[model samples]
Target: GGRGGLAALRDTWQPGPGPLAEAQAILADAGLPGRPKVWRNRLTQGNLQLRYGRDARWYRFTRSGTEWRMDGPPSASPVDLAY
Candidate 1:
């Protein structure tokens, strides 16, 4: 019931489709091709990935082989990450 417990709970919790739909809309508006696959807070399309941060920012990632690594800093808009 302390900080550790809260962290564990946050880790296990999955955000609903609101974030995912918002990201999709943003990408679509930006004219990005294809749709991203959602898992937890991440959206992956091809080698590009975007993660919704707890800080209300979208983070960019790139897939290298089987691992996805952070590619840049976080932004308040998913459009920035999509580009």
Candidate 2:
């Protein structure tokens, strides 16, 4: 991502899915604890908050996460990993 430091990490952050229900499925299958919440975001076409606890609304999936592509190992979307 063009951004660096924490911004870069935030930009590349990717979770399971955008929808709350779908994201719950991903987290459940992976034995992870989190939830996805939708918010009105002008910066991004949409925003999904994936996390639990007080910071539950902080976790998000950025554009870089979607752009990620790999041919080696078992690289898959968070949703794919859940299954």
Candidate 3:
């Protein structure tokens, strides 16, 4: 059997403070919606905790803000994208 989703995310996702910043920049450059805010924790496999506004939701890597489909998108709204 394989590790659970959260375990897999914790094992595979390596978003250092630097790389994470760069990823955000890429998102900004691509003009994608939603902001990558504070990283809560690896929620599950193929999903991560993205803080936006006063809430945090789990989102997959490929899912975009507009495609979130839920009442609110899953990406984070960090205080500073340059962080």
Candidate 4:
């Protein structure tokens, strides 16, 4: 069944588990890997902040609703997202 196949694919493609579990799941469904390292409070109203790291670089992200944008350069300090 087409619906069953879709559900199977969804289940198989889900992320294992980590810091940004929910966000990672959502991004995985959307074809992007989620790697949320830090959560910040930007001075802007109604904006959610996210910090992610990959390879050896960190990135600051700003999320407005479902949309996301990069805010700054990678962090110089090492962050452990597993916490």
Top model number, lDDT: 1
**Mind giving the per-residue lDDT tens digits that candidate 1 earns over 26-76?**
766665667767878777777887777665567777789987677766677
Query: Which pairs, if any, clash in model 3?
Result: 5-45, 51-76
Off by over 4 Å in 1: 1-13, 29-33
Give per-residue CA lDDT, model 4, range 1-83, as digits (tens): 13332232223222224534444343334433333232321112234333333222333445656865655444433131111
| Alpha-carbon RMSD to native, per candidate | 5.6, 12.0, 11.4, 13.9
TM-scores for the candidates: 0.72, 0.24, 0.33, 0.31
The local distance difference test score of model 4 is 0.34
The candidates, ranked best first by lDDT, are 1, 4, 3, 2
User: Each candidate: how many clashes?
Assistant: 0, 0, 2, 0
Candidate with the greatest TM-score versus the true structure: 1
- Candidate 2 structure quality by residue, lDDT tens digits, 1-83: 12222342333334344444444555555544444333321012222333211222323333346552221222123354232
Question: Candidate 4 regions off by >4 Å?
Answer: 1-46, 78-83
**Candidate 2 overall Cα lDDT vs. reference?**
0.33
* Rank list by TM-score: 1, 3, 4, 2
Q: How close to the true structure is residue 29 of candidate 2, measured as C-alpha lDDT?
A: 57
Each model's lDDT comes to 0.69, 0.33, 0.34, 0.34
